[model samples]
Target: MNEIEKKIVDQFDVAKAWSHVQHLVEKLPGRYTGSDQERQSAEFIAARLREIGIEPQIQPVDSWLGVPDGATMRIEAPEPIDIPCAPDTGRGQLISGEFIVIETPEEARQLAGKLTGKIVVIPYSYSYPITPEEARKQGAAGMIYGNWGPSDVDILRVTAPQTWTYWGLPDPDAFRIGEQEAIPQGHIGRQSYERVRDLCRKGKVTGSFSANIRSFWGKSHQVIADVGPDHLGDDADFMIMAAHHDSWNPGASDDGGGVAVLLEAARVLHGARQSLKRKVRFMFVSGHENGAYATSTWYLDNHWQALREHAICFSFTDNPGFANAPEFKIEANEELMDFALACARDVVGDEPKINVHRANKTADRGFFGVGVPGIYTRGAFTQAQADAWGGAFLGYWNHSNHDTLDKIDPVNLERNARIRLLEAVRLCSAEILPYDFRRTVAGMRERLEGWQADGRYDVSGTLALARKFAEHLDAFYGPAGTRDAARTNETLKALARELSWINYTYKGRYGQDIFGVDLKKPLPIMNSIDELAHHAAGSPMDLMLRARIRRDQNKVEDALRASIALVTSS
Candidate 1:
């Protein structure tokens, strides 16, 4: 690290950041969306921003949320027995049906006709092959998610709420199904899951599940502030640093640590504002745990034009600074992977193990569809540790009452904050933005070629476009040093917007995909490539897919052409 970088890193006070985390976790427990505690947390964050001479804007956003109250489950068949359970954010109601364990979505589909009025028990994984909406459509009466962790008596899991609409909670379509028609859902521990499975092996098992939750539309606050020069005016090019402030059950690690990191980074960056060439927008969003990124979605919708025109990149922090997690994990888009990895190596020495992954559909990732390249950094357990703990990410205590202040380590917290500060300073102060489109095009070509090898569909034209784009990247970046920095940066940003739109989103630039649906594949629109083989040629389904592919082909080709035009024009 250089002298300036070292000086900025030294300015981050670990004690101050830890104090913030302690305050949030201890004084304000249960910072659920739209709750009084959440509002107070926003106020607390805003006050901190003001203390550092940055005026904060606390914007109110109306969102629909389901807050869990309590839940119950009982087996009322041959022998009456009560099972311990925790409620997901499904609707509140009592429903009884025959207990049927369907391990996978395909199994549920195979047993479609028999699923009506049946309570389906599905095992919990990171990504669900079948969602509650699909289960509802298949005529299932209720749902129970079997926790993936150990059968320890202390652990009870409640996951983030299920949302069918895009960007979560704001869409009118999400409310199209009335509460009367909604299905009740909850989670049972592994021991309960084993007992239920054994009971199902017997002749027939009848079970009753109920969840008491309060679902309503209310207002939540988002605290936003900017640190840097004002001379660039309204269309100033800026980068975003954001974290969600609301979390479940004294969520010290899930987001309290993230909030603390953002605060400390902002304070340190404010002192170096005069050295920055671009603005740094700090957003403390709400409604992540319960409302599914409602406030972040609100910002995207309200500021769509500005974000598309001037936003450079998006960086988010979540679930950082775990006590026993020695491994550093960096999740970034291909465009920013190289830069982000270098920053990680700077913070944690190059000798330590660092895990690199592609960005996914979590951690307030509302910026993806907006065409902003993003990066997320966190401390994570190694593979062996994760396996020993029953595959929990941070720990089995995640999103539970056990996520208390004891889970945070001061040393790890300082390391996380230092990494955030380095990334922010370099991104804001660099004369030329650090983005490599070559890496992006290489990934695109790989995905397209893999699809082409499948022989299910002809992606030759798209593959050619990707190759053509790749050939021009060297020439595009060759003259960057001698060119006008502002013009060159603008061209790169515009190209990124187009490439990210096609690479990350299937809904194009204007719409949002349904929340919690995995779109991790490169060029997610082409995911339909495998589906074409399922239907006979010239059948209705096949013809429909053909039409959709043609449109998507046009989308990809047009984006590549635009990218080419950008490079050549610059």
Candidate 2:
């Protein structure tokens, strides 16, 4: 390592960062957005940024904060047994209904038509959200979500708000519950859920759910720190270091570790600011856990003009010290994966080969949702977690109260900080942007064709255009030996600039956050196609939907056509 790199790396104290993690997780009540603890965390982060010679900016955002008090569930008929309940967004009213068990999504789907008027019990370990919207669509009156982990009956925040309208914006004008328009809901532990299911097989069971909760208007803050601003003068591309500071509990793994790493990494960048060719940004966002993404939403709205001009982001999260699963899944466009791996390797020994996995919903979702090229760093996983995911994954005490300071490994935390910091540094200093959209283009084409093969919908036209787009990509990228930095940077930026229009919400607003779409879909356009593919072949009533899809397809075609012209013209 160079003198500056070594000095900055050595300057980072994992113990000191862990101390901050302790303070954030244990000393505070919880990091729910708008809470005093959350705001204090913001101040602490701001103070740290100032200590490192960067002024922190706190963007004001307004929203409603939901504070769940307590809840109780009891099986009345089978046996008068009380089941512990986790509070949801149910206004704390007692609810009574016939209990039905849907332990899996497949089961939920199989019984969707029969779930009407019953109090449905479903697993919370869903890859996709199994919301009260589905429950309501199926005619369920009340719902109970079962815990996944064996550890404890975890308390959960409002489920529906996660869908879009309520949670997508950092600060929404009014407090909107979930997009699912949910009925009364509560959660149960696995053990309790199993007992109820066993009782249900033997005979009919009746249950009641009740909770006392409070909601009120409140505000939260977004903390942003800039490093390498001198280099980011007009015309230079920039990068963002991102993580969420808010969590349901201590949240050491979910984000406490990440926030620690961010602080230290920002310090390192601050010390070596002159070395960078681009500006480096650090963002600590609130409304991540409970409010859907109030901070990100407000940011998209308030800073659209400036942000629209920026290019890429580097996101970090889930830095659990538990080294059970050595592999980490980084969500990046296929083109950026190699650079991402190289960034990780530059930091440490690089023994365990980093693995790339599809994206998931996280703090970085905001950047990727808007078509900004970004990468997500997952926390280490346990063997159990590895098997549970069946691939490279992250499963730290996500949203659980168990994510305390003690769980953090000082060494691992430091390594993660170096990985993130060095990655940012490398990206900022690199003359040419490290992204190649050819892979992403090919991947999208393959996905479209794959879905078409299933006879779900015919995407031949889109597939053909994808090939043309790939040709354009090859032409723009040219042979590496023959291309110059300016041309490469311009070409990639133009590609991102156009692709975003295809991937993001209409008019470039954060409107797509309102949908319950998978962030791991690789291509947002595919998510849209997938969202409508099955329905497109359904009843005649889908004419409007099909028409809309046609319009979307037309837009996709137009964007691709324009992108090709932009690339070839230069």
Candidate 3:
């Protein structure tokens, strides 16, 4: 590691971070987005920024949020038995009906016909736990949601509460639902699911629930504080180091640990700010748990010009620390990832297995919508390990009350802090940003190949473009390091910006983070090409379908050709 980065790494203290997380998780209750606890959490983080001598700014975020009242669910048959319902915001949403249960999407597809005549019961497993929208077409009354803990024990899960799109943000006339719109729903524990499922096998099991979930317009926030010189050279680019502060219950691993790393990152960088070559902005964003991506989205949309001129975001979430034995990942092309990993390897000595995601999914989802190149990192474990750790499948403690401060280890926390700190330093301090577009070309090709395997479509159109882009990128990253830094950075940014617009926005513009575009995973641009080809050949309406698919195929082909020209000609 460079002398200055080494100094910053040595300065990081996980103990200090632990104290902060302890206060955030232990002293505080669940910090759901827009809750009083979340507001206080923002203030607390801002206060810490001040403690480190960085003036903090509290940026406002508006959202649609479900304010909880009370809820109850009970089985009327097989003798009346009460089942605990977690807090939700479906005011006066009461229902009584027979039910259908599903654990995975395949199961739901298999039972689609049966699912229509009853209340759909689904377990909280993947990111989405709601009854599939397709179920409504059949005629289901509503839904009874069940949450299972890592263990076999029944776990009560309270979801991030936002009914309308963009979490709780105000919507346009066409966009507004006017109220919480969905099949009326409430949650029960795992044991409740087993009981109801067992009774159904014997005979019909009818159930009743009253979801008194409430919601209103409330303010969420983003806390941004920077550590570095006020003025930088014209060529110098700034970097954003980010993590979410709000949590469900004591969200130690879900992001309390991540926030702790950001805190330590700021303090460590603050110490070496003068010597550093570039500016670093430390952001603790909210509205993640509730699904708005409120702060990150606001930043991307509201500050587009500034971000476009010069900014790359490095976001942190759900860090499992060293003990979790989690994997490291980045969405950028290979050169950038390699540079960052080399920096990380210098410190922790390769204990972390880092990989570059070919087709990006969830991570700092806020930035991609607005065209900023972003990198996200986290610590994760398998379901078995997560279960043992009292963590849900996706994270150690995703959205449960059990994610307390006890999950943290001081030494491991610092190690995580080290990985983030060094990467941010390199991005900020490097005169020429170390990014390569060939990785983008390569990643897209990989996704296309996967899609080809999934469905038989002639992807040669997309494949041809990927090859051309690859050739140009190879020319840009010269074998002798003879490329101009300024030109390379600008070209790479432009490519990523266009790619983001096409993948994440409507008409290559803005839309909802979750609904507007694919947030967790950005599918291939020609994702359905092969499927359309196969359908044209196999379907009864082959003539019409082929004609229509050809038109779209030509349009996408032209767009890809244009994008290739941008890099190739430049």
Most lDDT-accurate candidate: 1
Lowest lDDT 10-mer window, candidate 2?
152-161
Superior candidate under TM-score, 1 versus 3? 1
TM-score of model 3 (CA atoms): 0.85
Over the stretch 1-570, how does candidate 1's per-residue lDDT look in tens digits? 788888888899989999999999999988988799999999999999999989999998988777877889999987898988888755657889998887765676577668788888876766675677777887888888877666564366866654544465544555666355567788887668767878887769997988777777887789999988756577788899999999887899988999999998889888878878889999999888777688888899889889988888788989889998888888888888899889889888877788877777676786777788898888888888777666676787888888998899989989877887888888888888899999989988999999899887899999998898888888887864568888888888888888887888778787776665666678886677766866798899899998898898889899999998898888
TM-score-based ranking? 1, 2, 3
lDDT score, residue 104, model 1? 63
- Model 3: per-residue lDDT, tens digit, 1-570? 867778777888878988888888777667877778898888899899889888999987776556556788888886789888875435666778886666665676566567655778776554443343455556776677666553366767766545323422546641343343455667777667777767776887887887776665667778998778656654456788888887777777778888888887888888788777678877898877763566776777776777877775544545547355565554443335566567656866866566555324343455554566666554445445656634354442346675666566676677667877888877777766776656555666776666557655556776687777788777766663666767766776676665654443333335543432323333333334543543446677565555655554464466567667777766
CA error at residue 389 for candidate 1, angstroms: 2.7
Note the Cα lDDT for every prediction shown. 0.82, 0.67, 0.65
What global local distance difference test value does model 2 have? 0.67
Candidate 2 all-Cα RMSD: 3.6
Scanning candidate 3 in windows of ten residues, the lowest lDDT window is 515-524
lDDT of 2 by residue, 1-570 (tens): 566556656677777778778777777647778788889889989998998789989876775556667888999997799887877656777888899877655676577589777988776643434556677777888888766554333333233234333445423342333422457777676567767878887889997998555655677678987778563665556677777888777677767877877887787778778877778778898777666677776776676656666656546554545444465556665667778777777665667656676554545365544566667654466556644432213442445666566666676777767666666766777778888777677777777778678765567888788888888778777767766778767767667767754554333324444434444543455444555543445667356566666777777778778777877786
Residue 525 lDDT in candidate 1: 68
**Candidate 2 vs 3: which has more TM-score:** 2
Compared with the true structure, the alpha-carbon lDDT of candidate 3 equals 0.65
Query: Which regions of candidate 1 fall more than 4 Å away from where they truly are?
Result: 77-80, 102-114, 178-181, 197-205, 230-232, 479-481, 536-539
